[model samples]
Target: MNITVFCSAYSLDDRYSAPAAEFARLLGTGGHTLVWGGSNAGLMGLLADQVKAAGGKLVGIQVELLKHKTYPGADELVLTRDLAERKAQLLARADAIVVLVGGLGTLDEITEVLELKKHGLHDKPVVLLDTEGFYTGMRVQLERMDAEGFLPRPLDQLIAFAETPAEVFTHLTTA
Candidate 1:
């Protein structure tokens, strides 16, 4: 299945590069095509680079407004007029969504996935990869929403978690 993975594009900072590359390698090896933000910043470029190195098919979506002069993570670039168009195209192409550790942009990407699933626009699985327990707090926060009745108990199933790269692949296969 085509996997649309959302991640931060902050820069090639060591703090984010290693983890992102780890999963990118595994996802590619697992035979899941990768689609992500087309940027050479932060973990975005690193992940795409690793996937390409592993002989995986990668499809990157770029927006005219967000063009970085040089895209860091794209091989097959699909340029759109704006961010909104790019997001729509990405969501349309992907079978599932995997989120790596990232900031606001990453969060926003998967939020669209959640909203889409909530509205019955799609029924694809969404994964929150919790490498090194990075997403523990966030998971707890989601649980709080369930407890407060803002989120349906079963809606929590929309988001799945994984610890290592192997686990992420396992979920993709079993999903």
Candidate 2:
């Protein structure tokens, strides 16, 4: 599968770096390609670097304005006009989506894409790489939604959760 990894463009912690790199390695070994934000810093940069080092075929997308400030040396950096265009391209081009740790930007990207899918704008697999239970609140809200009948039971099925990169690799492969 051509997987678009929607991760926090900010950075990653040591706890996550090893597993993230491992996941990239495993994905390449399994003959899958990767897509991500193009940067040479932050978690996005680390993943792209490690993926390439591990022989993964990874592509990058970046908005032009942020390119200079964010992307120092991206292998396949594709500079676009704005965030909206960049996201639209990602949604249209990739088959599956996975998100790692992130802040507001990451939250916005993932949730917007999910909402789009929810409204029938897209049909694809979305996975949440919930390393160390980072997304506990979201999961709780999902349950709450289900309980309140605000979200369909099947909507909860729209996302997959794994606690580790190894588990994420396995789940994506076996899925």
Candidate 3:
């Protein structure tokens, strides 16, 4: 499977990094490919390394403006004119989506994907790997939206939540 990972562009604490590496290793060993933001820093770099070490393919998508900041590990590197194009490419290429701890950019990626799914643009599985209760608030907010009738579908149908990497696979398979 081609798993597009939405993650932080900056390095995070070991709490996030360790699990991310392990997740990458699992993806590699499981014969899954990684599609991600094209950069050689932070959790992105760590993941690239782990996947590569385990013989997995890395496909990176980056915008031209950030060309200088890209990493060297991608087996395939695709450049986009801008962020929107980059995101479109990411969404188009992914078989499944895994969202990990990140800031605004990551949130943007996951939200747009969810909205697209809600609109029937795609039916790919979207899983949240929320290590250490990181996404508890997001889960609550989603429930609130469902309660208020803002959600077009049940929260479970829109997004799968997993507190651990192992659970992420289960959600993915069953999503």
lDDT tens string, model 1, 43-99?
877888888887677888877877764365455788899877888988988988888
- How many clashing pairs per prediction, in order? 3, 0, 0
Q: Model 3, residue 92: what's the lDDT?
A: 89
The total of clashing pairs for model 2 equals 0
True-vs-predicted CA distance for residue 134, candidate 3, Å: 1.5
Pairs that collide in candidate 3 are none
Candidate 3 overall lDDT versus native: 0.90
Assess every candidate by TM-score.
0.89, 0.89, 0.97
Q: Write one digit per residue (lDDT tens) for candidate 2, span 36-144.
A: 8776677887777777767677777888978775545444667789999888877776878888887887888898887787677877778888877788998788767
Sort the candidates on TM-score, descending order. Answer: 3, 2, 1
Instruction: Show the colliding residue pairs in model 2.
Output: none
RMSD of each: 2.0, 1.9, 0.9
lDDT score at residue 34, model 1, on the 0-100 scale = 87
- Would you list the clashing residue pairs of candidate 1? 11-42, 39-72, 40-72
- Overall local distance difference test of candidate 2: 0.75
Looking at model 1, report the run of 10 residues with the lowest lDDT sum.
66-75
